[model samples]
Target: MSTHLCSPQHVLVLNCGSSSLKFAILDATTSDEVISGLAERLGSDTPSIKYKYNGEKQLIELAKGQAHDAAIAELVKLVNELGLADNLIAVGHRVVHGGEHFTESVLIDDNVLTAIEKTAALAPLHNPANLLGIRTAQQAFSTLPQIAVFDTAFHQTMPNIAYLYALPYSLYKEHGVRRYGFHGTSHYYVAGEAAKLLGKEREQTNVISAHLGNGCSVCAIKDGKSVDTSMGLTPLEGLVMGTRSGSIDPGLFTFLTQQLNYSVQEIDDLLNKQSGLLGISELSNDCRTIEEAAVEGHPQANLALDIFCYRLAKQIAAFLVPVQRLDALIFTGGIGENSDIIRDKVITQLGFLGLECDEAANLAARFGKEGLISKGQAHAKAFVIPTNEEWVIANDAARIAKEG
Candidate 1:
């Protein structure tokens, strides 16, 4: 039997993004959420931090020009003021890119921090902010050990064939231009949970987990390990996301730069921030907004929604070929959890593969709950499992800390 370390009393989790900080406090023993909230619009005119603890909401108004470090310090202050700091046994930070080095969560040390910094160029928007959260938390909680739980770590199990790019070997050796799938912790958690729901050992299960949020990826889990995933070297090479283009022809970028007089930076901004549902809808990136527009007879909004579901279904089917015998299909993340219509459409396209959606069940599974949403006699299990990436980070951190 695999032994798990005795859980900690409490663990604080931090998810720092380019311009925002989200923090969570968890009761490690029960894996229950104590509180969670976000610091949004960082470095902007109305930079603000909102936190909730013990079922009460609190807001912190920041002066203009608040940096990431300052935002983290403020989060620390709020947690302490709420009297939860006394129970904090260790800190867990979400690091986006671990390159090829970190395969699992590791206790943070000077060397580990340095190694993470060296990989910053791989995830410029995420790694820097993540590093800042780690350092700032270290300074604030000097007596406690901090752990780095990576988003890319869970995907390290991907075989060589699945991770390697067809590009020249020399380029792979010179630069780390290979697939490092993101949303791994979520995929890892949900896949195991799906196996349990199916009354099967995780190691004997085959599942496809779709994590569809602003940033999205579909992971193919075989025997509890990632066999294939939609995301490539970066989060950019996957299904259509809120503002991201997902996957675009490489030749288009070259054509834009050479013929249309666009710079590399301009191309990156256009694809990463000005594309996807927003570009196609010509409205808002929010799915709710797009759905509203579609209801009002907006052809572009309907097209964007259709294309998003079709692409997602197509990719999930592609991953299914490798697993051969898929036991379950799981949908998690912001869009997947709440958007019943989108879930129905995606699953409808997969009916040929013995996937049948129970529309009523899909509509009822919402707000961090898990439920079966496939017809009773369907050959494959379809489920909606709300993901808990922060809890995964905290569990790993607490386990590693206990071991040491």
Candidate 2:
């Protein structure tokens, strides 16, 4: 193959979870994905990687108990065997908690890695895996630049009033305790996309973006900057999630311990792993399952669906206070993009905002397609746009690599 000045360069974006590694190689010039895959069920009896290339999907099995480092090594070997390693420019990692240290994506170095590690306490399940990916990638591709894009970076723009908890100021001053929202890359990307759909410049766009996955967050964006967000300190503080009980009486923890003889760890496990939709419906954590049961006249399922929509609408209303004006409301992520029933229920409660959902349009927007789901002449509209965090990560890496 002949090399040319305009040859497409690729940036590999990695999102390392506790038990899985999701990756995508995207053409930096055109923002198109060349390949995407997931290596999951690691450190278990069965570990495997599913990769897609040239429109063909294949799976690679690994020995049991393989870890992230070994998973990434296999990926690197695959890239090299395909003769694509030479065109790889950089690797971008998704770091879940940057705290206050990173307001933007930065090329990683020793000090940056240390800062990320320091914030590990704020993100026990995420930061360590993130750092692992960073370290492993460094060893696999020592010559290329590695960038850290933070999940909390966009919400670092929030003012003190919005992020501060009502707890004593000394806790925040001494312990670094405050709201540090997650899913910022998704929020920021979809906000920009929302602006384009509204035919407005990013600087003039104001909106509320909801990312409703297993872990969910809602962001209030003013002129493209996050003014406020739902998740606080940790990801467990926001909307009712697949398993996470969103916001609850802070004293409930003590109540469980005192009255129920539950240990602190047990209470934590209850709220974070056993509550929310699953607890409410006594069925499944999945929204689809709950909606289906509700349609079949299950009382608990109906109650859970009502609570989810009501709580989500309340949070959206609270976020509107930060921006003082709204242009649109965007729904993204699994539940947001695919569930028209939940969207309609949430919007029906927000009638005071002069927003109306166009049911037919919402029905048309599924399987990762964008659609406008608002009635004509409404002051504020609702939209469903697919979130592209990997694209955001790759773009940031490319820009930082070019600057260097």
Candidate 3:
């Protein structure tokens, strides 16, 4: 909340993409962001960094376009300019695929870097970018410990029965091909918040949580750990997403190849990039765009919205097998926390156990506000709890820094 000055032990969080990097400095004691920024269009003709510090926003153009190196160099200048670098304790990097090796956050070292590189095969687009950010942060903050927080680590608790696909056991053993769920950090954060709202420890809570954003997934959290999730192997296997096709018939791939002469690479792009809300609505991938179009008598947009709600409700109902006694159904992430319309439609389609969606409560809970979106005295309850994954990363980084 301060403008310029801050105390010690702040955690610097870095979430790096192929061409963009997001950085945040959080007070270790309060989890409040001291400074936050993003760098975009790295390695492009017009790369730029934007940051907020001391209640004012600033922008700088990185003409060199030196990718992560340039962005992090600018970040170092920003931190040093604010005189907050000495107070920083650790840097947290969001690595999307940790495979089975990283069951928890670890202080980055030679072995950790090697392991992250090995897992790059699993997340081709994310892990390499994450590694670049880690190495750059190491250069920028050489003395500070860099911590790797995995997106798949929390779901490592899932029993083999839930994670193992029906495919050959040899494939899993040899190639490490099995269902390793994503969004564990987000799921873990919101589950704890849900437990607090329920007046129970996270270990005693049971709920199904849906994180609806560009990348979507539903997690069945039983006893504070993920038992099952909608996503498998990759994020593309979950409920319909902003641009992904979600779960599709495996035969469709063969069908496309045979009937349309589609290459494997083409199929991958079709399913992972061109499908979902964008493909169905033939307009935009954003929920707001589709919702607005549906209101204006756009049939395709309405159909896309309906399919999203239906499939999401189906997954929620299916997750009941893992979450035997549901405490509350949670909605989080961008769309889940903001779109009252999507929440209402999805809850209505959840036929079993009759979840009463209070229209007023649903509308009131939007825009980052957390509250019960169910009627009073309803048998089943649903809550809109905004997720704070960066908080989790910062806490994990600080704890690891202290431990190391």
Candidate 4:
């Protein structure tokens, strides 16, 4: 028989990016963040670490060419100095891609480390950094269990038809090439929150989750499970993002190579880093900046915003086909939660779906607050919910720790 778990403890959540590391300490019982910080520009000439504790901010400068190991050491030191190390029962790491291996958060071990390494090829820029953090934490706090909470794990519930591509069978069978969506943590968390807001059981909720930041993707959740998502094999395949050219014609590669004399690598870089909103505006990839410029009658900026909102709305509408009903349209992430202009413009395009935007609510919801922006007989309500991936990670880790 399953018994009640022990009292909650603090969990340290680590999220490692290509050049940055974000760390947080949270109380599992109360869902309160005790402390948080970010270490940026690692391996660059000017590296800095900034953290907040007890409402005070602190900064630390690093020597030239310092890397992940050094940054982690500093984090360990900070946690100890702040007297948070002993209460940290478990450490949770956010791993970007689990491929098809991990379906949920698991305790980190040698086998898990090996599997994460094997999946590195699928996420060149992320997995390695994540692995580094896992290893460093294992060494720094050897006694505590290190857990891996995957960003792709939540979407593993997707059906075969939704994930399989039209590529050759052998490529998929032999190379493990298929659509594995990103931002599953954010999607899952917000979906749960949306379900709560509606006072419905999670198994009965259906919502379209849009995560719009520098990297954007939309997820279709039917009955609390991800049925389909915009992002595919790589993060670069979804909605047009800050610099990513989402869902471009494959023919563009051949055309660029043949006519523009572009190499495969060069074309790859162009699409992955040079396109999207920045490509459209030829100014900035930031939505706020683009919005300001558009208000000033900048043609390209207006065009950029239009294309982003229109494409996003179309994708949201398309996702509706997979669900039994639409309960809510959730907006999370940087722009999704904060930018009323972007939210209003996207909802304007989604008028056909009966989503009406309440201007006051839309404007009121900013900087990590929740707001229901739809009104009066709308088929589905629209919301702005701030995502807390670190909280999810901490809770997952705490559960695993208690189970053991």
Candidate 5:
């Protein structure tokens, strides 16, 4: 499917959501994308499949509203028609939570599938969809291997001090209720890229990576391994996100229950769905909208952004304890890679650490471009390195499948 000659290893990666699915065929060796597609509004009134292949974009409408089974079937048919089945060496599925069972990417077997199912309760919304994608992909590529890449796998190296909860020891032992970070694939990708920029081997590198997007988390990497991260047992425990009220006070839950007569579900919905920039600004959840509104001197918009940047700056500074000497500070993700204002605001707050934003450099790194957004002579610099999680997944799939 690639415009050029196909590499020896190509992987079909699937990242499934409850009502949507994203897929891509990538050359693992060269990190080049061959085919990319998104299926949205599945099992609804009007479902649609949008894809890019052979350097052209196309869309297919499903009037009857196809579910996962039918949508996956259509995708498999498209791949077969394009003659990419034989070119694909493995199928990689992105599983959001491995729940301590998985520490790294692995070739999926019956045991792995069962283990993934067992952990579904921990990620009630994500793991099941991930499993569905894997199961369907297994049916389509019966003879080929199916591999799994997890969002929590890279942070499995964190010590007890970084992941343990103080509430109760029994809660963690009986229910596995300890911190398990998310966005591992993104963090791992950028950390390696940051190491490359610093001209140091990964094992010799120490840095903090802020993955600011619709979902945000800050990771502290000490000598190539994740030592600490802001996210806890769930993705809702870190920096303020587009919708999630990250790291809220536990007492507020009780206060809402007693005072407002709010149920557990209502509280959950309020925090995860109606909070963050949308709640504070009383407007859109999108950062661009909030940033533009803030520039226009909207009071709530300015407050929302100010709080977001302050929290992010605090976490980035707190992570310094894990990796005492900062080699570099890295930013990646939708907002991190594009927003010069957010980046400058967060970095300038860390002036004590010798981090200073260079206006020209920061401005130049927007819209998917990569650049060092720090004063050239600063002892500790910052960078805008776009993450490539799919590349990491494809290569992991290729390597683990070969190990079999």
Candidate 6:
């Protein structure tokens, strides 16, 4: 095998979730996106793949009930059919849980694959699909290097005091259970971006990054390392998300099981798939719809929105205690990037922390751009920096491939 480095290489980044797959092609040398798209409803009645390149959108229809492998095969076909670069140097996959084994992005091999599989039980909904994507992509693009960028990698730096649960010592040791936070890629990226924007060295900056979307988590990043975070052993222990309950009393689970005759599976479904804003609103899981309902005087919808913001605000404050100086607070993800109302509410709630929002600046930030939302004289700065998890994954893949 040649040991020479490949320049101007193009790396493909893959983010495979439970029901969807998102892909991006990037120029490894410049770290700029060449094209990006998504294949959604992978195993549903209507599976559709959409690719956007050079301002052109192409949509492909797949047979209903197509699995993850089938979806990746179709995606590869689309990339080739579009006459995109064929010299794909590497591929990066977004694996949700790496447990305590992997603390950084790694080149994928049989041993690494096995380790990821062992961690699957911790992220039942994500790691399995991620493994499927990695395997399928490796087979489809034989001879190309593949890497795994874990969502739990950034939070691996968390201290024992922050990660340990208040449960039995036996549970911690016997079950390998602790606060292994998710959304590390986003938190890691935004914290660096925020420091750059603030004209400060990453090692000298302290930040709280809130990634709010279908799944949300807040991280306390000091000197560019995760000191504390909201998400726990799984992604379920964080701020209220689209359909997942954030925090709940453990006793409630036992009560629901014994008194209400609810099984463990039912309880799991309620906390993970059917709770959060959807369960509270009884209307929709999407924040936009819930916000609309709230605006129209719907009591439950309004209450749900309030609860979401309040809990998020309180959690953000909790993380601030770890940082000696809170340089900035950043918002990223779906709802955080687009919704001005939610941003405003959160800022208002954090006024005690010296966060004073410029209302006009807050409203001006939208459509995937970074901007400052804080008053110039505010003690702690606030920013809305859109996250690019795919870019991070691609960069890691390119570096690993080059090193080998």
Please provide, for model 1 over 1-404, each residue's C-alpha lDDT reduced to its tens digit, 9 standing for 90 to 100.
Answer: 10112334688899998889998888777787887889999988888988776678988898898877778788777767667777778999999999998999999999999989988988998999999889889999998889999889888988889889899987778988899999999999999899889999999999999999988899999888888898888889989999999998899988998999999999999999999999999998999999889989999999999999999999999997778888999999999898888999998999987878887898899887789998967668899999989889888878876887
Structural similarity to truth (TM-score) of each candidate: 0.96, 0.97, 0.97, 0.97, 0.98, 0.96
lDDT of 4: 0.91
Best by lDDT: 2
Can you write out model 2's per-residue Cα lDDT over 263-316, one digit (the tens) per residue? 988987998899999999999999999999999999999999899889999999
What lDDT score belongs to each candidate, Candidate 1 first?
A: 0.88, 0.93, 0.91, 0.91, 0.91, 0.89
**For each candidate, how many residue pairs have backbone atoms clashing (under 3 Å)?**
0, 0, 0, 0, 0, 0
Name the TM-score of candidate 6.
Answer: 0.96
- With a 3 Å backbone cut-off (N, CA, C), the pairs that clash in candidate 2 are none
Worst 10 residues of 6 by lDDT: 1-10
Instruction: Provide the lDDT at 112 for model 4.
Output: 95
Single out the weakest 10-residue window by summed lDDT for candidate 5: 1-10
- The C-alpha RMSD of each candidate to the native structure, in angstroms, is 3.5, 1.7, 1.4, 3.4, 1.2, 3.1
lDDT of 1 at 35: 78
Error of 4 at 165 (Å): 0.7
Clashing pairs in 4: none
lDDT head-to-head 1 vs 5, winner: 5
Candidates by lDDT, descending order? 2, 3, 5, 4, 6, 1
Which lDDT tens digits does candidate 4 get at residues 326-379?
Answer: 999999999999899999999888888888889999999999999899887976
**Which is better, 5 or 6, measured by lDDT?**
5
| Candidate 2 least-lDDT 10 residues | 1-10
In the predicted model 3, the residue pairs found to clash are none
lDDT tens string, model 6, 325-372? 899999999999988889999999999887788999998998897999
Worst 10 residues of 1 by lDDT: 1-10
